[model samples]
Target: MTNEIYMTSKAWPFDQARAILRRLDIEKKRGIDRGDKPVVFETGYGPSGLPHIGTFGEVVRTTMVRNAFIALTEGKIATRLICVSDDMDGMRKVPGTVPNPDELEAYMQKPLTDVPDPFGTHDSFGNHMNARLRAFLDSFGFDYEFMSATELYRSGAYDEYLLRALNKFDDIMKVMLPTLGAERQATYSPFLPISPSTGRVLYVPMKAVNPEDGTITFDDEDGTEVTMSVTGGNVKFQWKPDFGMRWAALGVDFEMFGKDHQDNAPLYSRICKILGGNPPVQFVYELFLDEKGEKISKTKGNGISVEDWLKYAPPESLSLFNFAKPRAAKKLYFDVIPKTVDEYYQHLDGWSRQDEKQRANNPVWHIHNGTPPDENPPLTFALLLNLVSAANASDTETLWGFIKKYAPDATPENSPGLDRLTHYAVAYYEDFVKPNKAYRDPTDQERAALEDLVKRFRNVSAAESNDGEALQTMIFSVGKDHEFENLRDWFKAIYEVCLGQSQGPRFGSFVAIYGPEETADLIETSLAGNLS
Candidate 1:
């Protein structure tokens, strides 16, 4: 059977992550050598909001590292991409721009299960967001185990862990209480304790019933019932300690989080240590920026999603963007998307060039998990399209055939360079692939030059009428014969005269690859712009 390339690798550019992995690998081997269970990397996300581009970067990196470990072991060793959804996280505030945002704030400090999804199809808002993120990951081809907090809570798997953490909740809370905000250790909760008539806080024990209704029953110290009707389980704990207990109980080894969680990392870490479990991969990546350099947030109605970018570029291009260095504070705009994609591929191609010793230790060289491969056809899009159209023509000769029909007296030998066909193809596809604009036209100077060249070509004597070479020499002799900087640049100049654009495909290759008269007809029709 053929071995499929695992699209992941270990030698990534992020130095901190790679260093952590190396240590973890040693630890895992040492445990196994000592006849102990092996530890794996673990990651999770809260499904309270839409999975934005920032989320994509974090998860993609996680997947890349997970696959890298697997590839490192030649598929014999094992690692997992553990995806936990914090569906139990409370609704803080109604995110902005949500359809019917008024109702969300009502569910504040309540489990996500209580809120309705924006789409209103799911049982609750939490379910809707979770489902959307799950769909995005699935479409992205991620292999993972999807676990929801609601189900996990109801399963009783976290019962022991939650109780243990709750026993230590006082000490943990004491540490967090004083250090949390600017206030003292004032706010307190021992798994829903109640204030006595005398004003003393007392504990109120709760239990998750097997056949009991899935809701937390709150009561006063005097035994008067307050309320009931929680989902997931009959028992529950506060947020901070609960998350710590959940990680320990879930056997998560590593997980990266968003920058928003940076402040909470210490609290969670303390909880994990207190509960006798290692914190999972606790890296915090930066956020994504909009065109104006502002952080994108659904509440602000300023976020651009992955689905939006995917409409203009292919998946590979998206992957390329993900693999690029994660900037802590750089803004991403739609205008930069196309150029970045081309530069990414071009860099990959350069890395794969035949110089083995040039960049032997380069991180990007190993980013692809396998030897970097070339993407073929190396032809620009306009040229390719022109080629396709010309290829169907009756006669195939010099690109001059098409040029001659477009500018009957012009010499085709004055064509622009061919080096930029690939670059133009990339830019055009990345930016102009959707809702294509009109053809790039030529400038007045370029048009005058073409007119002069065409007139000279027609006046060529019979002795110089052998082929395009003779025509080329005649045109060259009549003018100063200024050299074009490059093919695309020159074409841009020619196009300004012919079509009015700064860049375009190689006319010669287009007509040659395509055909002569067909290309000529296209030019005559497309470029007949007031050329009296």
Candidate 2:
């Protein structure tokens, strides 16, 4: 029930937070003075394309761990989350999802911060995407400081680290060269100098390195040899070197990345140490897959974005999706929305009944940073979607008409959460469920059972019809009397005949909410082969 119990929680966030504490202990034992500086948490972003769902996931997951660390320390330790955008990285290729692909082709190999903004919004493509990233994170009310790699490099923030990297260039190369193929290793250099001739980031090998002068010499695009300072934005490290340099320069205490970076993690840590700074505690989460089980890519735009998820579901549901089984690859698509929405509310509904230890492990507690909302929806999302299908509702008002009748006390004003769900249900039903509906004629046995149910409904009293449990009992008896082998098949028949779906909400509750007489009429319509 206390913070002490939560500190020992088996939740993944707490596990990661504990790793940070262990790292701090090790550092203190080594006589490393961290002083009163806060433990820094960093999440990186590549601003070559629009921010995607994967970007959102990293921030959300990191925030969860940060909150866990705060709870474990009981506010004794200060913390900061830095969201740094790698805008200075070269535009290797034009993203398929962005506008004006042809225009971007001219800017290939240029730093993303130097490319023109295709949307005509910000000064550069990188700035536009950075703005979008900040806006997206701001909408979630995340507490973070946004840093641009270009700004950091140009403003002398990275000068010291850049010069240190120059001094240890050969050692850094020794860490990286083994990872590259023969052809790549032949041309590889830790530093990528920005060419003065073409203003492009050249991938050419360094001709000479002067640690004293803190500069590098490389040939320009026109085959003219040039020497430039590695400091003050004149040069940027290749990605692997940049990753470790960022940890050292920023004094990052904790950070997380995708599984794709797992193999390179050791190299990063080594480079960080080589640059005279300790590597941060790192957490490697699994990558997200698209609907087809292909890895999601920012350039290819193969997966959904945060805005896409928000269109059919609330933000809390998306947060729940990001929170669940983070180390396992999840299929991010529209089909998962309804299930995640229901699961989010299910967790919320159970949060109050859970003990402190149980609550600490609940996803909603982490989603809300331990202060989850007290609101509970009257119906599950699955039930609402089923209601939409049965009622053929196209709008929120129509859905609410039946909802108000079922629960007289609930209104759009008092049940804001439920009201929002109604809107999402209607939208999701219209976009996904309706077009794919397949209504089939019942078999002879199913028809007989349906007729028997309609006959029983005719004799039902108003009080029994209003009570979901009572109606459920009656429905169960009908299924048993009709010799249905599996009760699930009987429910399936009801869903297919009346709702035009293979699965749906509880039939008894549907009957109670929609009225017994109305359900009987629906079955009769289905029997007449007209419901679909």
Candidate 3:
């Protein structure tokens, strides 16, 4: 690997915001050179309920660009991944509707803003949601500063910024109201108002004070009652400027947000300038749609959650989808994921085989069919899945040794590597590919092809040929109707013959890479229903 990646490609097709960040980095560094760290970027998220794969996508892309920035400036400048959970934003309703809403009934009728933490120990409902997201980030190996809105408010980090925005409330409001709808502006009790006729600003007054019955007032016009029994305490400013005040106090350099928060960015920018903070970095990613093409949101309850997808799929499979495109509107379903995941990784593998110079510029965006011939073994997850459903190879050491012989580049590190492999294998064996559950069962056509292919494969020796390409081509020859309509049809056919199912793996190449006898044995056991 070289320190410099030649631009074999101009830029990654999926990331325009990254290109913007790179340009901004040059400007940021001019400031950093004079002895300022210039915290380069920050992104905001809401912890109202269960986090989704889309959430992971936002953070992962942020982290990758941060890594690029750190690389670009040679470590002179610093960037941080600040996961700001808008816990202080009023909680509208319990997201999932727990069976025991009564159990949480005590928390109702309070400012729908601050409900009790579902996990019971956290100070508020927002904290509970933030904790869930934090757990997922930790599981994904992201390094970030996890901050809760409630903590920042209680700690008074936003005190100075808040006071400044409050003082300039009228000026900031002039810039804010035109952005809200007329009807919204009319009843905009909690929002900053703008003149409908002139779009001139009218600021909402805000302060940090609690009323007699435990209600908290923003500016003395109207106050929200604090649910003291459910949550231990309550303290907040009006939501609009609170975010702007936050951007300044946190030194957030860059943050990517979903489109739902598009209106808030301008307001936050105004508040950032008012509070004397740098305008935080901002990128607006699109939404994740449900199988039916509806946007996934707390109100819709329509999308598959991150936890749900993780149940029967590989982490990288999820990564593949998120990384494959720029954040744009796309349809997703829990079903038929393996077909997509296999194709994606194969495409990645092809990219790895591309000419080195081309591979350097955009390492992650290479097309699979063009990947350079590198020693990088397939992800342990793909290999293990093939083994689980192809043959009865249970010994991790044996598998590792085989991997060393074939692709000496493969590393057997920690449980994550193992877990990743186990997950993919589960998806393959189950033949179903949703977040919650997936099970594999070979079709009649697949079984017939596998039985024939296995008989042909037995005639060859384990060490005779190791080239994956030649092996794949040879297997394709055995099926008279070998012309595949797409990658899915080909993969399904391979799995069928090898494991007595329509799809299992690339048999010829898998056997060559994994070895002949082991490959045969795996297929026999999986087909016999002994391995899954």
Candidate 4:
């Protein structure tokens, strides 16, 4: 209810915010004067390829924590989310998913910002991907300041940090060398100088490090000796070193990354402290998996995109997916869409009924920044999909016709949320549910139960037919009377014969919405093999 109460909330975002507050308290006690600075939450992006769902998840989750922190502080401390794109990093390999892959091969070792744009739209490959990243985040209306690694380096924004890194080169090397293979250890350096002649990032071992002059001497690809300043875009830190350098340079207060970065987290923190800066609070979440349970990869493009999710469901559904179980790995696929959509509405419907403490733990509060919209769709997504299958509805108008008949008071104007769901339902049913629907003839006992159900429906009064709970009880009684070994088998038979699918919504709810006599007619048709 109150900000003070919410400060002790058990919600994951609130928990993360509390960790940050504790970190600040510790720093203040240590005479670090961090109270005046706005807490900075950073999410890194490598602009070598198009942004993926992982990128969206990180930014959104960080935003949730940032909002929670603001609420906990009650506007006393400011917060900022900086989305930094590492466009200056070298492109190791061309992504297979992008257009014109062959054209990008020549620029393999060059910084992504310097490589040619395969799409032919932006000045360079990294610029094209970064624009897409910005557009993606902007579409969600996220509050973040975009920073380019190329711009930050070239404009001397990282000059001070680069000089610091130069001075701590040996210390940084001590932290990195053990993790590398024998051959990689021989060539690895904290600084990767951009070659003047070839304009490529060289991964050569430093011949000499001159901390006093803030420069490094290394052999070029041609075996020619060269010297370059670490500052002013002359050099960029390798990814591992860059992670800590960014924390030190920006004074990042919080960051959340996937579990893939868990092993190197200590390295990042060590390097941050080595460079005379405190490491930020870290939140490590499990990685998202594709439908086949493989880790989702931007380069491989094995998982659904944000646009793909929005195509079948609303943005709120996607947010709910990200909000739930950040610490557990989840299968991000099309099959999970309808379930997530229904879950989102379920949360929305229950938000008003929840007590203050319960509301604090609810995902919808974090999803909508503690102000969830008042939307209570009367039907679940599963029900809508079944309605589409049974009525063979191809458009929202057709689906809305049934919705109006089922709930006389509900209209497209009064129930805009349901109206939107109808559109998504039609598209989802057509794309996913329709093509896969399978109809099976009922067994002898199942046919007898169906015939008995038809008879019972004909005898039901019109008023009773509209009562979903009453109808559900009647269906359960029918299943019991038929002596079906498992009630699930009876429901499965109904789904296969009547709905032409292996799974369906509550049959009683379906009868109440579709009309009892109409459902009887459907059963009779299935008995006569018309549905099959």
Using TM-score as the yardstick, the better of models 2 and 4 is: 4
lDDT of each: 0.54, 0.90, 0.56, 0.90
For model 3, the stretches where C-alpha displacement exceeds 4 angstroms are: 1-35, 95-100, 109-119, 189-241, 263-278, 298-302, 313-317, 334-423, 431-507, 510-532
> Number of clashing residue pairs in every model?
31, 0, 43, 0
Query: Which parts of model 1 are misplaced by more than 4 Å?
Result: 1-10, 13-21, 25-39, 94-108, 116-121, 182-185, 188-244, 301-303, 344-375, 380-532
What TM value does model 3 have? 0.66
Worst 10 residues of 1 by lDDT: 1-10
Clashing pairs in 2: none
What's the distance in Å from true for residue 215, model 4?
1.0
Model 1 TM-score, 2 decimals: 0.65
Residues 1-532, candidate 1, lDDT per residue (tens digit)? 1112322222353343444455566756756341344445556677767787766777777776665555444555456666777776666677776897876665665667657676778998878888888898889887777787767877877666655654565567665666556442343443533222322223454432221333334455577754443322544556666666666787666667667778888778778778777666666667778788888776676755687666544455566666665536556666555555555556565775545433333334434544554543233335433432323222224333444443454332333322233334333343443234245455554445555555554454545443434544443443345443343444455444443334444454443333333334444544566321
lDDT of 2 by residue, 1-532 (tens): 1268777788899989989988999999999998999999999998876677888899999999999999988889999999999999989988787886898898998999999998999999999999999998998999999999999999999999999988998899999988999999999998999999888998999999999998899899999999989989998988998999999999999999999999999999999999998999999988889899999876577888888889889999998998898889999889999999999999999998999989989999899999999989888888889889878999888888888778989999999999999989998899999998888999998999999999988889977977889998898898899899999999999889877889876788888878888889989998898976
Q: Write the residue-wise lDDT of candidate 3 on 81-175 in tens digits.
A: 67877765554455555544656655542332356665566766666667778888899888888877666755767555555554565666676
Q: Which of the two candidates, 1 or 2, achieves a greater TM-score against the reference?
A: 2
Q: Across residues 1-532, which tens digit of lDDT does each residue of candidate 4 receive?
A: 2277778789999999999999988998998887468999999998876777888899999999999998888878989999999999989988887888998788988999999888899999899999999998999999999999999999998899999888888889999999999999999998999998899999899999998998899998888999889989999989998999999988999999989999999999999899888999999999999898899876577889988999999999998999999999999989999999999998888999998878888899899998999989888888888888888899888788777777889998999999999999999999998888778888999999999999999999878988889999999999999999899999999998887887777889888887788889988988898873
Candidate 2: regions farther than 4 A off? 96-101, 298-301
In candidate 3, position 221 carries an lDDT of 25
lDDT of 2: 0.90
